[model samples]
Target: MTSCSPTLEPPSPSRIPAHHVPIIPPPPLPPGPQDLAFSPPLGSLQAPIPPPPPLPPSPPAMGTAPPHVFGLEKSQLLKEALEKAGPVPKGREDVKRLLKLRKDRFRSDLCWILFCADLPSLIQEGPQCGLVALWMAGTLLSPPSGIPLERLVQVATERGYTAQGEMFSVADMGRLAQETLDCQTELLCGGLGGPNRDLVLQHLVTGHPLLIPYDEDFNHEPCQRKGHKAHWAVSAGVLLGVQSVPSLGYTEDPELPGLFHPVPGIPCQPPLLPEEGSPGAVYLLSKQGKSWHYQLWDYNQVRDSNLQLTDFSPSRATDGRAYVVPAGGVQAGLCGQALLLRPRVSSH
Candidate 1:
């Protein structure tokens, strides 16, 4: 009674077309027997994709730089550091020649040693500034006695440098020198100051190589330079002005015609610098007799080096007057803190 059947409205012209709208349904597989006899069904247990040949056992974690076969590449690096300082020092051409001639031998020396691409990006792993320096010095001073860096890492882990796989604490390194490197080592510079003049010479005189830390600020360090991202280099030589150093002369009798007498019981003293050039900047040597001054290496050469000869020593008194002299030519002064590393025959 309420209403007749409601009229249905026809669809609008926009609603539907004469052609049917199709859906993208996947196609069905062809039937069984043919598939089994012909090519196996796409669903059959195909060779399990072989898991990509096990991915070559994966590489040692990320921060690692590829292992380099032996060689200092020092000559090339030194040339780069010095040529930037100023007119290359007197015999740089010779050093370059040595580098070229000894290049093969140097590589042989660094060959088989493991090195990681240490960078600031790896800050979480700990600063590599000290590590790189040690790497160079240990290789140089110890001569044929260094473990691959990866192995060093493992040994450090066993020795309790367990904070991060690639990180070694100062103590960790000291022990590493003892346990793994089989040599004695000491931290020469800590915090923002350079080491004492005579101390560096003493070590060099005794055949110890120094590890110098550098940074852009050249202020607080152990890591970070503009391009350096915390850098280090091996201090291999001391540019002493004179060959032999004499001890102080003291006289019990002022009336004696001659200069003061020598003490009887003194052991030979390692030459302490004259007040003249108190702490002469160390004359860095990568190779002997090449006259490389204050040579340093940077793994990341991120910024141009600022190596002007900054006098580390101002000179001590020959008698009374201080004897200060230019330490080295245009020192790259990559040093913020310095460390002394000496290799003694391992009791082990």
Candidate 2:
């Protein structure tokens, strides 16, 4: 017991004098602008701001060739073929000849034509293999001779039809011409590999049939073929004229071109014609005869003063006049025991 107590007492002296150092409170912060009494600096509490997020990645650069050139090739080919064909001829013979020539020579001539055509440099630099066959067919028949092939190609290519700035080679032209001829023969013989017969016919009938001059300097030469100019002119005129027709709810004075004149009133029921063998609103020309005649369907309704006859005939229609029958109306007889009918209005 004495030993334990003694040891405890000594411990006090050895372990005693454990001094505690007091943590002094930080000095009062100076007043900030917002704080009336004592406030820390405005931004003191916030950690240093992080740098802003990195900007978005830039867009990838575009390749040299513009995207539209692909479709333009076909159009350019068509235009070239038309130019080579010269103006459309009146009879089928010229058209057939032009078509045959194009089928024979286009490929061989394309490279030179494109060079002269003046296509864009980008296209010229790119591979022109895709357009070879089309170019050949277009150029062989329609050679652009006087014009710089490069410039024509450039213009055609601007519409995205040809390679930009590419030069033509005679070898390439020859190969292309051969290929185009083969293809044309196949097409003419109804051997084109797809359901394209109808499409080809439609194109031949409606599309531009002239060959453009490749030589920029060459004044347009009329195709040596006959009737080409007249046919081309007529077709162009018809197209231009058709655009002038008025739609429903619009009345056009035939004298005024292209402008729409509003029709204030509703359309009246159209007049009717009489029986085929009898007198009616109009008369039909016999197949054996050269001309047509008009008859009064309702002689009472239409006075003699209102009737005016014209010599015009529908160019495309067979046997010309078509008739509409009017129910619950009086029927009359035409002269010469002929069929009486109403005059047919032209759509265009």
Top-scoring candidate (TM-score): 1
> What TM-score goes with each of the models?
0.37, 0.16
User: How accurate locally, in lDDT, is each candidate?
Assistant: 0.35, 0.22
Q: Give each prediction's root-mean-square deviation over alpha carbons.
A: 29.6, 40.4
Candidate 2 per-residue lDDT over residues 1-348, each given as its tens digit = 000001101011122333322222122223333313344568799565555555553432432111112223435653343334322222222222432454442222211100011111111112332232233224323444322233333333433222432212222222222333222211121111123323222222222111111111112221221111110000100011121233344443343223222344554222122222222212110000000111111111111211111111133124443322113111111000110011123369
Error of 2 at 330 (Å): 75
Off by over 4 Å in 2: 1-41, 45-47, 55-166, 169-348
What's the distance in Å from true for residue 141, model 2?
Answer: 22
